[model samples]
Target: MAKKPTKDPNYKVIAENRRARFDYAIEDDVECGIVLQGSEVKSLRQGGSNIAESYATVDDGELWLVNGYIAPYEQAKTWGHEERRRRKLLVNRKELAKLWNATQRQGMTLVPLVMYFNHKGLVKLKIGIAKGKKTQDKRATEAKRDWQRQKARLLRDRG
Candidate 1:
């Protein structure tokens, strides 16, 4: 018998923004619920969504996700969602205030890190408070990563 792959309660990632780490210095992370249309939810389940170019914004005392691309469901013709529609994010007032304050600071912005299904099977977006990294900072980050990889390889070979 083989073990079947099951959705883990911890997290089942749907889409991830790989470039986020390389482009920004992440400061804080907050998991937020997303308000999705009927067709959008189905499209996300089918697994072709993209959050790589998406970001979160505070608007009129609420949070909104901008530029995330959830492809229209193929089965739904006229009712399909727009590919790049802005979706509302569900966060409490306190959390929203924190994000709003942080975003008001210089060099700080909100970026969506990943979208995942939580333990309750609800879709969530993990947004980060980040600062744009300078060219030198990016180079330093790459160097540190390279060194870590080299160290791990050397340790494995010696064992």
Candidate 2:
């Protein structure tokens, strides 16, 4: 019997954009701090967030996360945050410059890959600087993955 993987109580993933890797070719990634309201943080702690359709952008020399969703905290009805709101991301000047250059000059995209709480229990967002893939490129990637899976199966059977 196989042993199940242990779960870490402190480290938890609130949301992940699994399609980001499939749709974009990630060139580089950076972890960023997000500005959130009290209610937003409480909602995220309950795992009521989605990063699948969200992205990051550098605007006016500041990094911002766009279209990210944090569900409303029912108890905080009076001070609940908007479900979808633009949130500022914290990054150093040097990293901000790099991301700006990648997007403006190189025409790369800032895709949100994952949103989670680190070991210290602070929220972090991982954004990837990626170039969008053409349809043919996506098909090729799929084929390559399939071949790798088949090869691994064949080796296991032969060994």
Candidate 3:
């Protein structure tokens, strides 16, 4: 009997921006749709996009995603889209207005967290409205994380 071939795991990652966690204290999060070109969507399905450096901005009452990186697919015959193009976020006018109001406070900014496809195969972006954290604040967060890890280790040893 012939053995069946092993198939590669299927994971269609749209994008992810890791920097949002380290630099900001997130206040609220919103999931919104992404505007995409045909080639851009094709590239996204192939995987490996970066949203870690990307940010969301409200300009002229529209929401824009900046610095998101979606790489070109290797097998595509035609031209792939630019690596780091600003993509418009597809949100309703009222939603954008609300987000705009929420982000207008001092030290508050809109940041993209992760871009992934839903079960229905629609692309979605997780955006957060956050306040920039101070250096001491980041240090304190790190200290707390370390303490938690140590406490977990101690509990595991005892139990």
Candidate 4:
């Protein structure tokens, strides 16, 4: 029998960067801090928090994540944080400088991969450095993925 996928116990996904996979070839990943308001943090824990439309930019010696959405906390009072505000991403000086340099080149981008709570129960963001893929590259990737899936299915049947 084919083994089923296992879910991690500490798993709680706040957001996913779907376009990152479709558009870019991720080269390196980094875990960074997310500065969120109290209400935003509360809402994220309740689920449906996603950064699908988000992308990263470095400016003024800092990294920013724009277009991320954290829903309003239902129980929170007024004066809540903005749902689609640009949030700061924490990274060391060397990484920040490197990202800025990489972004200066054409077709390279910084994209969010996932947002989840760590073992310490703090929210974290997984960022990736990637280069954009062309239309033909996308098609090739899809074909390879389909072939792999079919191959796995045949192997399982034989076993």
lDDT of 1 by residue, 12-125 (tens): 789999999999999999999999988888888888799999999998998999999988899989888889988999999999999999988655799999999888879999
Poorest 10 consecutive residues of model 4 by lDDT?
A: 5-14
Q: Model 2: how far is 4 from its true place, Å?
A: 17
Candidate 4 global TM-score: 0.89
lDDT of each: 0.92, 0.95, 0.83, 0.87
Q: List the residue pairs that clash in candidate 4.
A: none
- Please identify model 4 stretches exceeding 4 Å from their true place: 1-11
lDDT of 2 by residue, 1-159 (tens): 999977767788999999998999999999999999999999999999999999899999999999999999999988889999999999999999999999999999999999999888899999999999999999999999999999999999999
Q: Global lDDT for candidate 2?
A: 0.95
On TM-score, the stronger of 3 and 4 is: 4
Better of 2 and 3 by lDDT: 2
lDDT of 4 by residue, 5-110 (tens): 6766666777787778888999888889989889988888888587888889998888999998888887886867888889999999988877888888655799
Which pairs of residues collide in model 1? none
What is the RMSD of candidate 3? 6.4
Task: Identify the superior model by TM-score, candidate 2 or candidate 3.
Answer: 2
Q: What value does the lDDT take at residue 86 in candidate 4?
A: 92
Model 2, which residues run further than 4 Å from truth? Answer: 1-8
